[model samples]
Target: MINAESSAERTVAGPLRAAWGSRAEASALADVLLPPSTALPGFADPERWPPNALTRLASVLDLARSERGTPWPQPTASQYARFFRDGDGDRTDYETPVFDLDHRLTRAVLAALVSRDDDLLDEVADGVLLLCERSTWCWPAHEEHHRLRGAVVPDPDLPYLDLGAGVVAAQLAWLDHVLGDRLDVRWPGLRARVRREVRVRVLDPFTSRHDWHWLGLDGDVHNWCPWICGNVLVAALRLVDDPADRARIVADTVRAIDRYLAALPPDGSVDEGFEYWWNGACRALEALDLLEHATGGRLTAADVPVVRETVRFPRLMHLGGPWYVNLADARALPSGGQPWHVPQEWARRVGDRDVALHAAAQRSTAIPDTAELGRALRDLATPLPDHPAEPLVGSVWLPGTQVGLARATAGSTAGPTLVIKGGHNDENHNHNDVGSVIVAIDGVPVLVDAGRPTYTKQTFSADRYDIWTMQSSWHNVPEVRGTPQGTGRDHRARDVTVEDTADRFQVRLDLAPAYRVPALRSWWRTATLHRDRQRVTIEDSWDFADHGDSRSTLHYLLAGDVVRDGPGRLVVHPVSGARATLVAWNPSLASAALTVRELDDPLLRTVWGEKLTRLELRLPDPARGSLMIMVEVCA
Candidate 1:
C-alpha cells in the first residue's frame, strides 16, 4: 500500500503557486465559455435504453458489496495508493510502476450509483475528490505547473497532452463533480491552468490544420490517440467561455470521429485488440453520450446495429477467454491486462446486450458472477430465426499492402474458417510474419498464434527477432532459399477461392502476386480439410514455377511443448495436451528437422513459457517447385 496523505501533501500546494500564470489564463477563458445549441452527428439515440440491464448491473454491484463486506463493491483509495508511487515517474517509458488503481474503483463506484447507493457513492466521490486535490493533476509531469512549463518553454507543440495526461485529468474532474461547480471552487487555480494549457498549446495548433495528422511524427495512427484526444477537447469546451473556440473544438472532434469511424473495417474488425478497442471505442461512445446529454438528443443517430455488431465481432472470433491472436499487434494469448468491461458499461447504456455479453465473457475471470452472464450471452448468441448463409467475413485490406482476414463457418464442428495474414513488415507495430495462418477446429485452436511479450528496451532491441512469436521462423509459412521470406511493400494475398462439399472443404489462397522474385512466380498455397465424422485430414500444398537453379524450402514452426514423437514423426503438444502431428511429404529430397528451444529472452519468457518447438523442412534444389504437408487429427 501507499501513504496517500504523505504523497498528497508533497504534490498539491507548491504546484498551485507555480500555476499562477495558467490560473490567470483559465479565468480569462472561463469568462468566454458558451454551451452548444446543436448536437454533433453520430451520437447514440436517447430512446433506445435497454430494459432491466441497469437493474441487473445494480444487482451485481449489490452482490459484490455484500460479498466483500464493504460499503462499496470495490477497493478503497488507500488500498490503491501505492500504484501512483512505484516507478521513477518517467512519462515516455511504457512501464508505469505506479498507477492510480483508485481510478477504476472510482468508476465502478460511480457506475454502482445507478442502484441508488448514495452512501457508497458519496464515500467514493469524497475519497476521489480528495485524492485528485492532493495528487498531481497530470502524469509524466506530476503537476499542471510542470505541464505548463513544458508546454511554454521546452516543447511549444505538446502532442501527447490530448491522449495521455490531459484526458485523464478531464475524466477525473468529470467524476469528481458532475456539474463542474465543485471543481471551480477547491481546485480553481489548477483547473484554470489546465484550460490555459489546452487553449494555447493544443487547440490553437490542431485547429490550424485539417488533414489526417497525429501528435508525434511516429506515423502510428492508433485508435485511442485521436478518440480520447477528441473527448478531452469536448470536456474542455464545456468550461471555456469563448464561443468560437468551443465551436472549433466541437467541429474538430466531430470530424476526427468521422475519420476514426471510417478506419474501422466495414465488418467491424479493429486491428488493435480488446484493450485498444476499449480505449478507442469507449472514448467515441463517451463523446456520443456527452453530445446527447449536453444537447438533449439533437445529434444524428449512430448505426446501432453496426456498432453492436462490431462489439460482437471479437467474441465470435475469440480463441479462448481474453486470448485473441495477433491480427494487428494483438497478443495471441491473454495476459493479466485490464479487461474490456470498463467501456462495456457504455455499450449496455446503448441497449446492446450482445455487446455487453462479449465484454462480460472477456472479463469473466475477474468478475465473480460472469459465468451467469456468459450463459445469458450464449442464449442470446443462439442461431437467429433467419440467419444468412454466407460465413461472416471480418477482413480488411490496408493501404500498406496489408491483407488481414478472419472467418467463422456455419456448423459447430465445421470449426471457425481460416484466419489468414499476408502483408508488409513496415506497417504499424508489425511482425515479420508474412503468410501466417491460425486455424481453429471445433472452436479450438489447432494451429496456434504465440501472443506478444512484454515491451521493454531489451525486448525491442536484441531480443525482438529472437522470440518465436515475432519471428517468421515460428509461423506456418514457406521459407524462400533456406531463409525466411523477406517482406516488402508489394507483399499481399488475393484471388482466394473456397469449395465446400459433403465430405471435404478446400480453401486456396494465391500468393504469387504478392512476391516480386521471378523464381517465386506462380506461387500458390491451398488447404483442404476432409471431414469423416470424428476425424479430419488437413492437407496443404504449395505450387511454384520458373526457377532453373534456385531452391525453395517450406517450413512449419511448431510453437508449443513437445509431448511425444516417433523416430520420423514430430508430435507437438498444446496447453491442453492435445496431440498434433507434423508430417512432411518430400522428406527424402528435402530434409526435415524438429528442434525444441527455450524462450531465453526475459520479456517473452515471462508472458509465454520458456520452451517452444520448431519443425523445419529444408528443400535442396528445384527448377519449378511444389511442396506439401498434411496434418491429421483423430480421437
Candidate 2:
C-alpha cells in the first residue's frame, strides 16, 4: 500500500501544468506564430480539476516510487534490456524501438511528488535529467548504425529529433528546472522548437492523413488511434498560445471524439478487445476532461452516459483475472501492464470506488497500495437493481448468426457451465479456430478452444496457415474437398436453438457456409448438466453441386500429457495438470493434422501463421451421421 503522507503531499490538481509551466511564455510566443487552426478550443479557461481523481493518482504515484526504490526482485536486466534492442525483419518480432525511459522516470518522479515524497522525487528527478542528457547522445548514433545495415529503422533520418521522445524530454526538463533565467538560457527556445517540431512532424502528419486519404487509418472498430492522436494534439495545443489555432484544435478533437464514439454499439460492446479499451477509453476521457477544463464546462453537456457506458464495456467483458481476451489480436488474456491505471483514475474522477477496486483486483502480481481506493470506487459504481442488461450481441449476423451459449448450474463448482461461439473467424486478432467451443465444468475447462500461438514471423507467415489450427481443416464442420475453408468475408452464426430444462440445457448454432463451397450447413447440440455427464454432439449436412466426390472428416487433436485410450476414446488423468480441453472436428472426412503448412492469405497468415498445431477431431463418416464427445467431470 502507498503511504498516506506521500499521497497527501503530491496533491497537485493538474500535474501536466507543473510539468510544462516553465515554457509558458515561449508557448505563448509559438501560439502567436502558428495559424489559428493549430490552437485547441477553450485554452483560456481556468483549469478543471478531477473531482476525486487525485486520490488514486496520489496512490499510484506513491506505489510506483516505492517499487522503483525498493530492490524488489526485478526481471532479469536482459528482459528489461530487450525492449531497447533492434527488431528482426519479421513484423511480428518488431518492438517499438524508442524507449521514453527518461519520460517514464520523470512521470515516476512527478508521481512521487504527488505522494508528498519530496526527497524521493528529488532523487528521481536528478536521475531522470541525467538520463535524458545521455540518451540524446546514445539513441541517435545507435539508430544510425542500424540504418546503415538496411534495417527498417523508424524515422531513421530524424534520429536525434524523434517527436514523441522529444515531447517527453521537454516535459521532464520544464518540470525539473525552470526555463530562461532558471535553466540554461537557451533551454526555453529549444523547448519551444521541440514542441513545434513534434506538432509539425508527427502530430500534423498523423492528423492530416486522417483528413486526406484515410488509407493509413487505424480502423474505427475500436478507439485507440483517435484518442492517442487527440491527446498528442492537446499537448501541442497546450504549448501554443494562439487562440485561433486553439479553437480549431478543440473543434477537430471534438469531431474525432464524436466519430469514434459512433462506432460503439449502444450496448457498449467493444469487440476490439480490452487492451484497446483502456488505450482508447482513457485517452478519450482525458481529452473530454481537458476540453471541459479549458472551456469552463462549455462541453459539460457532452454524452456523459456514453462515456460511462464505454468505460463499463471492459468490466462486463472481463472474464477473469486482469485479462480480457475478446475478438482478434487479443492476447490469450489481459496482462497487468500500464493501462491498469485508467480504471483507477476514472474511479477517482467519478467518485465511484468499485471501478477502482476492479482495477486493483486485476493486478495479481505486486498488488498496489491503492486497493482501498479501488474498493471504494467499486462500492459507488455498483449498479442499481433495476439497471437493464446491456445487449451483448451485435446485428451483423449473416445467413447463420453468431451465438454464445452458457449455463450455470446449481451446486456446480465447474468454472463456466459451458461457453460456445459460432461466428466467422475473429478478424482483429483472430485464429483459424472459428465455430469453436470452450467448455468448463465446475470451473474447470474440459472441451477447450486452443488459444493463440506466437505473434512473431513464424506464426504470421503463410507456412502456418496451411495447418489445421490456422485453417478450417481442424474445426467442427465440413471442409471443401480441394479448396481450404477460407476466411468468410461475411461470417456470422444464425438459426440459433436454445432450450433449458430443470435437469439440463441445450443450445444449437448454425454457421455460414465455407467460402467457394456449395451452400453447406452445420450445427452443434450441447447438453449441459446432464443426468451425470455432459455431452456435445455436432452434425454437418452439405450439398456440393460443383465439387463431386468430396469427402469430410472429423478432427480432434489432443495436446499436453494426455493418455490416449484409443483412436475413438481418451481418458485424461486427474493427476495431470491442464487448464482446458480443446475440441475441433471436421464432419466432411477432411484430412486433419496437429500441424500443417501455411496458407497464402495475407490476413490469415498474418494472424494464425503459416505453420500451426492444434487439437483436431476428424469424423470418418460424412453421410447421415453425427459426432458426439462426452466429457465426465471429476468433482
Q: Candidate 2, residues 301-349: lDDT per residue as tens digits?
A: 1345456655554554443332233444444243344444455556556
Among all windows of 10 consecutive residues in model 1, the one with the lowest summed lDDT is 378-387
Displacement of the residue 155 alpha carbon in candidate 2, Å: 4.0
RMSD to true structure for each model, in Å? 11.5, 11.8
List residue ranges in candidate 2 displaced over 4 A: 1-108, 111-194, 211-223, 281-286, 289-297, 300-308, 321-326, 338-360, 363-415, 441-446, 457-484, 491-507, 519-550, 555-560, 565-568, 571-613
Local lDDT at 207 for model 1: 57
Model 1's alpha-carbon lDDT is 0.45
Report residue 307 deviation for candidate 1 (angstroms). 4.5
TM-score to native of every candidate shown: 0.65, 0.61
Candidate with the greatest lDDT versus the true structure: 1
Top TM-score prediction, candidate number = 1
**Backbone clash tally (model 2):** 79
